[model samples]
Target chain A: MLPSSTSDKVFRSTLFVLGGSYVLLVVLLLVADLAYSSWGQLAELLGKPEIVHAIWLTLGTCTAAAVLSMLVAVPLGFVLARYRFRLKWLVDALVEIPVVLPPLVVGLSLLILFHLPVNGVKLEDWLRSNLGWSVTYAVPAVVLAQFAVAGAFAVRTMRVTFDQIHPRAELVALTLGCSQAQAFWRVALPQAWRGMIAAFTIAWARSLGEFGPILVFAGATRMRTEVLSTTVFLELSVGNLESAVAVSLLMVAVALVVLLVLRGLGVERRA
Target chain B: MIELKNISIVSGSFALRDVSLSLQHGEYVALMGRTGQGKTTILEAIAGLRMVTSGDILMDGRNVTRLAPAERGVGYVPQDLALFPTMTVRENVGFALKVRGVAKAERDARVHDVAEWLGISRLLDRRVTMLSGGEAQRTALGRALSFKPKVLLLDEPFSALDDETRQEMHALMVSVRTHTGVTVLHVTHNRAEATALADRVIQLEAGAIQ
Candidate 1:
């Protein structure tokens, strides 16, 4: 029999290679399938007005949702990272619920939330009548849904980022005649640049891929609430496999670009 | 003068009970203790970084225990220096002046003067990440001094340096105290460091001063 050490090494190497190859295989297959099926229709799909509009809508809403998420996430993240308080566990769980819940459930929950009465007022109907704003089956609902889910991811990323920073830096800044706000803005915020970038990108990418919530809350109306993910779903529902495949390819491309940009930024930061 | 009157602070498993200490104005006092003996805790209490469980802190005859760290007119140099990595040495040194909305010319002049005084004028343009341990210490000192604080708190500022560098830092600290006339509370575990630098050395065991 072989030595135990040699057997252990062989076993570990085999497991590692298998695990690595499995991940590589899944990604390769996805790309290959999209490219093979959508090759002929890709040009036509790109030129279509509805497709082009959906792409722009996806980009615009994702950007808006990402920015909105960050505006809230920064303070929430800082508090969660630095402070200890009663019900902190509950707050943390609430923040992460969206991330854990199925995308369909999140979408359904948002749809249900809009219909609920708030202090004797039906929020969805009241907004529609008073502010001329409709949420259910509307464009704004797309962004709202995206924000609900993507914001959670942003908060998680930022919290980890803030936690990594040395709290002494802020204390030192405060002792240097800086108010708490000044200390946070000048020291903590600057130190958290990498985390902010990562959070924004994660949120943006998540919003870009968000489909289930948008479909239920914001109906996939062509050129209105249509995004890349919804475009694929809508096309496939109508037996338009080529169009669905093309949209899938577009999404893959966008995700690839985002990953590449994130890597590039990481490299730049290190340099 | 800086005074901690019967301060009691409890943080998780570590506690400092009735830790009272005082430093005369322009006097450099060193707090020496074993590791985890609450030397830093007392310094933090004076700097308003820690909330005291009881008692008060007075700075220049003013009860500043309830004041915010920014309002306390205290400058702190943590053990790691905690220099703003993204900022150049000039920006790091001039952070306080900038925060107070001082004019560009005045801030620049003040930053340069402190940098020159700390012998880090040549390092002004360099990013803090590029600095060596000694340079980072001086940058932290210059930043703290730029605020013209009523009291300066140094937490083992020279503990990380070599003997030669530590000696240089001790000399620098002496000159700084003489020029600025700022009351200082320095925390360290090194008896040699405390003896070399402080006007009075307070020994701490457990939590209270021995």
Candidate 2:
């Protein structure tokens, strides 16, 4: 048998190198494959007006969804992190259901909800007539589907962030002549700025990669609801593999650039 | 004057039971106890951070049992200081006044005055995370004092300081009390600290004052 110290060292070193290399290798391989496939087609894809429009649509809708998610997540996360009430576990589970549910299921459920009759009136028809907007197979559906899943991630991140903060900060603010709202806005929310950035970034990135829900709920209509992910899927279905790879590479480049910018701006999650 | 009449609090497995104490106006009282003996709990109870299950808290003969912490007009410096790390020292010190919608000129003036008094005038532009232990404590004290609270609750305000710094903080506390005449309730486990800072030292055992 090996000496206890030597065996322990070996075990740790082996696991560390193996685990570290595994993650790095996967990412490197994916990027390399995309680069190789799209080497000549990237410029062509970029030149296409439809592809350019899809990229812009993805950026816009993802940003809107991420911001909307944060607006919902902040208060919900604060309540979950700070307060105690009846069936709090139930509420927590409900918030998390979207995270665990299949993306396709989320799309189907939302589609079903919009179709359901409310008070003897069809919900979709009522919304279209009253608000002059359509949800199914529309641009709004893309945002809604992205929000359904991405908002769950935002909530989870925010909850963890608020949980890390000492509640005494808010309490101290209160004792220092701040009303509840004042204490939250001044003390608690300021403390959560890094977390807010993290949540927004995670939700935005998740929204960018979202495919199943967007495709199922909002059909891939060119220059309308088609995002980069949908663009990739459409190109692949048309047997244009190089075009698909080009769009995928664009997504990877954007994600890397945005993350670098955020990090450069000193928005980081503290332990 | 502040009074806790038969105050009791139960938080999870730890509890403070039937705690009663009274401090005269402008009095500096130190609460001493072993760890887990509810010294901090008592201070929190008085600061309105914890709800007493069955007791009345009175301040200046007014029952403030159900009043929120802000309305209670108390200044609290918790054990860890709880400085808003994201804000500059000036902002942290001026937060109470800012939340009250005090004008920019007045708020800046008051923050400057408090920072000067705390010997933290030079550190006002620095972030709270950038300060040393003593500086953070001074900034926290300045923040608590910004609103000119009638009562001040300090939980081991000097526990993390070195010997020389702790001595300086003790002197600062004495000066603050003399100048402002704010009632002080300090919680500390160190007997010498309690003896050095308090007008009357109260010993706590199993949540009761002895």
Candidate 3:
């Protein structure tokens, strides 16, 4: 029983080697990209008011999208996971559509549909006049696009999280004079909090970096609905490589910090 | 008192055919079966987590087969003793009362009473994740008993504990039953647990009670 220490050592060494190599490859690419850009350009772009506005817009829209998605996705996910129903597979597939769909194609579809005429007037006008949302070339459009993709992701993640929680916990709560809603809030929700946090973080991060949808559906209008990614695109078109690099660097930093926070919360891995 | 009349269920790979059982008032019964015998399935069907293909579940002389779980008045503790790890012991114990819109003062009083009864008063502030297996089971039992349910269903309640903790939990169960007079329907793979706690034992094979 005490034998075979040598083989164990070899196996552990091999695992460490593989893990180290994978990490090194990603780190090396990041280092190379940073080295290619000058620090002065990165710093200059960081100080720009437009860049600040873009950062705020990106953060704001992403926060809204992620929060909205979670509000819808959590209950939907719980229902899908707990209940067996007709057309369940269809609902499940719909929740996962964004994972397989191309982001650019999704953006194009949103722009084409939203800009097209419905009955007589353009959807852009109807949205503003009827729905009270000035969606075209604005914050609403950006959020809509982000929500379209991120909502799907949140639903899928939340469904899995609900599945991981034991159904008995909910049953216990129900028997103890707790209503269904109360059981979910007090029992299931607390046990699955880590997963919800993780799902929200992922959706938020994805929305923050959304480029194709913002560029196509929302348009890259300066100081209007321009987000971090859109700002980078606008800078690139005008030959402002320094600003573009700077914005990109800022985005990377924010994402890294967020990722660290998520990890600290113990949601990143388990969720 | 609870009764199951001609219960039957068929999932993809498992089936329970014409299973009938009854638990008398304040009775302590244990359900025993080998793996793949649909022991948990029966419990789930009674709890409204599984839809019975055909059955009538009566609680206190009223048919509750079609009722939702929240309406059935059946407290359940599953095999894993799934406690909310993020919540404190007080929150966990007070959850059912809180959900029923009980006043905060009343909820706290109930929580304190239950915690004392379960000998978990000192652990009111501990995260469930930090509790020992015995402690967790007590907390789970406290959660079930806090609202004074008519029947308590425990699935393999002591399967995860060491021998010492298992004995401790068995003693605690006896104490709980003695003090509260709550009917207990326990399911266990371990024979000793059934022998120790069950006033009656129902042996299940292939989803039918023997």
Candidate 4:
């Protein structure tokens, strides 16, 4: 009433509610999960061989997927950030297809992709026939699905990181007798190292959280292909809510640690 | 000698059109222009960082227009100094030699010698991010001169320094030219810098060299 229809307190309260609601919801979700699962019950669930296997498998596969994502993303990010070329807009959009696509459909696409006959041979069939390895409903499939989605996120992160850096340093390095490759390795890559770690952690966190694609592409085989996300699903499908929540909490913990490490890297603040 | 024969470069909104200039061996020349008048763009074209729409760049009568920046062996210090922030002063100074696969002992010796020459020997182990403006300028100069390149291009190297620091840098710059006898192309809009450091001054008006 003093100077406006909405009082300062009212405006401030509305703003806090709009923003804090999401924060509150997140806290409530974590709290509810923690409240539902007893420490002893979490320990008992961890004691299960299947759950233990899922834990190891989740850690291993997510790490592998994140590493794979990084390998593809770093170079992709560098090129996309540094160059101008034909169809660049199309290429940029194509890289983000998986990020926007329905995750389950991505899994389905991978499944069909393997079945596609190229040179009159299905890739999945070819692998099974020639290499004595099965990708579908297998361990490799889980990593692939995770990499497909997480790599997109990693690529985006790497691109932003590279964009934040000025190209002058690399130009100077080139003038100082460094080839393009040498400048990238010595100057550009070193400067982007913190951002690279942030990208990796983001990828790893994303890979850990990946569910739909893994379930569709890899099929939830008990000990062989069950990651923690899939483990949560398997537990919940059988009415084991406590176990599911505990595993979800475990994921939350791991993701929180990875994110904390990312914050420590301070790439975002610089950007 | 460094020669740009009617080179036209388009960089974003700035176009350096049909600008031609030459710096003879051991010549200390100042290229003066206002901001966004493509002063830095000229430095870049000579450094092989920017493409020329037409004409050619020559170093010692060798056509270097198509040559890569590394192949040209240009010593470029951008206005920002662009010192590799992640590295210590020692590493930054020795970067060219290291990339050229110079042996460890020789690289270290060269870096030490350059650092000492630039009065940065004591600062060698310190991170570049920890350096003051003048200290950073010296570090950058050390890095550029370390490889003994035939030509040195400086883009507004003193633009960020205070008057005292700028004067000191001008003195150091003259010492550098005298000691190395490298052809210098110092770009700046500051008349004082040109008067203090240059043997000849080339004016860049609009986008063309006059």
Candidate 5:
């Protein structure tokens, strides 16, 4: 052999190129699919009522679920971050289970358990009767399915956020005569806003990508529970590959916009 | 005056054994110890930030061991000098006054006065993140004093400052003690800080006072 150092350098360079090429290949495939199929057709399909309605419903359900998730996740994150309770790690692990669990498994599980009648009352029926909520195969069900998955994302991120904030600020506020609530609001909330916003964006994106749960629990009826991802599935099932690609392209666009906006916000906040 | 009667706080891996300390009005007592030698634990116990396992805390001779931090009237500036970095200097200074439901005009005037007294009047509009370490410490000090607390507990207020700033902070502490007549219990591992500002310096080793 040649010089050992030169061989080591060649080996590292080869590995680096291999890894980078793999990543580039995946990106190229995605671009090719979008470009060859639906990227040019988007302007024509932009006026389609069914597509428009699905987009609106997707945005609406995702927005509602994201908001509700934040409301629950923020407080839950605080409890998880600030307090040491029995089985706290178990609770944290349970929160993260959604990220690893197959979305289809989550959907099927919810359907099997909640869709069935419990003591002469179907869970969906009971919700409608008692809580005035129309559950499965409706907007509420779609949101619930999204919340179950996206809420976990918010909780995980928000928990880290709260952990990063120094409790001393809250204590200082308390010493100054602020009630604990006031301290949390005036001190902790402002400091944690960036992380909260980031968590919210991630949660919203998760809700947007939600398909299996929404499909199984909410039923992707045309123009009804048909969110963007669900629309792609429906289109694909019907051999409408162009429409499916169109919906996928739309989703990619939405995701790009969300990430860009969040990045800008993150930079602005830091400045 | 503030007093700790046999305060014993035991956090996992650290315990503050039967410790007692007192400060009369206008007196500044410095608690000097090495890091992790229970300096902070003692201050925290006095501030009600941590629960005393089997002892009592008294503020102005009132038993406040079980009272929440807000009700204790014991202003505490922790070691990190935890200022709300998102808030402006004026907002941070007025925090306690606002919490007490002081009127807007009164809170503003008090904030202005404390900001001026601490020589941070020019920094009132600056964010805590933008302030120097010395400036941030002063902002924390000003915030604590704004409440006109019955006592002040500073956990190494000048530890983060450079020599010049530390000297100025020592002067500021003296002025604060003179003006408010508030009893103070300051915890610092620095001998210089203790010797500079303390009316009495209490040394500790392990959990007990040496």
Candidate 6:
């Protein structure tokens, strides 16, 4: 028998309550952020030269990291989605490690990776002596830290994007005299442009909010590698709640604008 | 001629066991089978989209079973038509030539000629997504024939068309075979489609030729 009218009403209400609770929590968080930081406070924080420099640093590093993410993610995602190979499960598991591992642990892991001895020489020392460069606690380290984690997110997104696409078009391209690479560029890559944009957007946002890894791998050096997240940290450590909250609000505003732009492009429907 | 010599293909739980088939040069043939039969599999094998466990695929009397899809020199239109969604009709039709680094002038000329042949000249500048079923079919056919491959493979080409469009495409198939003189292997479960398009009809039952 069908559910009774009263029970059906209760069930429908339960569904709304369950979904609405999550929405309510998100709205409450936004409202709390807005209420805690005032326009005057935001303007005051923006007037600081260090804060301004940090904003530029955030944009530069995030873009660099996100671009790097796509460079590796697109090919890795395509391979994972379309081809079968031995140890595929291992690769798949490795991709998810970043998304699930504690953020600070990713930072610690990078620090250890640089310091680990290989062939009786530390990697950071080898790099400094051979290439006249060092990765530990450097600007490059910031980008590397963000990419290590964000690239995994980008790869997962691209994998889903490629999975949704039919392989027949690519196969047909091959039949039409396109080599494998040509077919990917002409057929699969074009169709995947939206996903690429979405992937870039997500990677940028993820990189933007990265703090734990950047903190441990690239120390919070003023005027050197400080980003908005680090700015928030430094502001809070000095008991400057206003500047911290102001920076938090700024990050939220930037993230909101990005999501709105993605929505306007209508990629959220697919991605 | 297009030939499959004692080929076997194993895909998951399904297998085409020791299946052999042939189509003489310039011949228009239809492959018919039930839903679970391997009609599409056979077409994919010939197009080099799928691997055969044991057998030889030959086009113009040269073994191509070991060749990549691009090296096999066959044109394939899958059941869904598999038109490049990101390209315009002209680009889709001219894709093969463009990939081979053909000169733009020559590519445009051949694209125009193929579009004209398929009665899709008016649709060349249109996006692939904008075309009706019949228009899309013609565009796909134009694309397949643009490079003048040795053989053309069609899988369920009319399955998505309305009755009127299906009849129209049958006439287009006749013209395509006559104009190109390319070997044609059309796969379908519909006997009427086979009757309407094929000079010879082959049947498959559970991956074996009947």
* Candidate fnat values, all: 0.93, 0.95, 0.84, 0.93, 0.89, 0.95
Query: Where does model 2 exceed 4 Å of error?
Result: A1-16, A31-39, A267-271
| Chain B TM-score list for all models | 0.97, 0.98, 0.98, 0.97, 0.96, 0.98
Clashing pairs in 5: A176-B96
CAPRI tier for the interface of model 4:
medium
Predictions: Cα RMSD each: 3.2, 3.2, 3.3, 3.6, 3.6, 3.2
TM-scores, all candidates, are 0.94, 0.93, 0.88, 0.92, 0.92, 0.93
- Separately for all candidates shown, the number of backbone clashes (residues 3 or more apart, or on different chains) is 0, 0, 0, 0, 1, 0
Task: Please provide, for model 1 over A1-271, each residue's C-alpha lDDT reduced to its tens digit, 9 standing for 90 to 100.
Answer: 5567978998988998999899999899787766667566888988899999998898889999999999989999999999999999999999999999999999999988888888978889999999999888878999999999999999999999999998888988988888888889999998898899899989999999898999999999997899899999999899998778778888878778877887688769767
Q: Per-residue lDDT for A162-242 in model 2, tens only? A: 999998889888888888888889889988988888898899998998999999999899989999999989999999877
Model 4 segments beyond 4 Å from truth? Answer: A1-21, A257-271, B11-14
Model 3 ranges with Cα > 4 A deviation: A1-18, A29-39, A118-122, A261-271, B190-192, B205-207
Better of 2 and 4 by DockQ: 2
lDDT of 5 by residue, A56-93 (tens): 99889989999999998999998898888999989989
lDDT of 6 by residue, B38-136 (tens): 888889888888888998988888999989988888888888998998889999999999988999999999999998879999988998999999999
RMSD of 5: 3.6
lDDT of each: 0.89, 0.90, 0.85, 0.90, 0.86, 0.90
Error of 4 at A97 (Å): 1.5
DockQ (C-alpha based) per candidate is 0.81, 0.80, 0.64, 0.79, 0.75, 0.84
lDDT (C-alpha) at residue A88 in model 6? 99
Residue B206 shift from truth in candidate 2, angstroms: 3.1
lDDT of 6 by residue, A1-271 (tens): 5657988989988999999999999999889889988999998888988888888888889989999999999999999999999999999999999999988999999999999998889989999999999788888999998999999999999999999999989999999888889889889998998888889889989999999999999999888889899999998999998788899888888777866786667555443
What would the per-residue lDDT of candidate 5 be over residues B132-180, giving only the tens digit for each residue? 9888988988888888887888887777778898888888888988889
The number of the candidate with the highest TM-score is 1
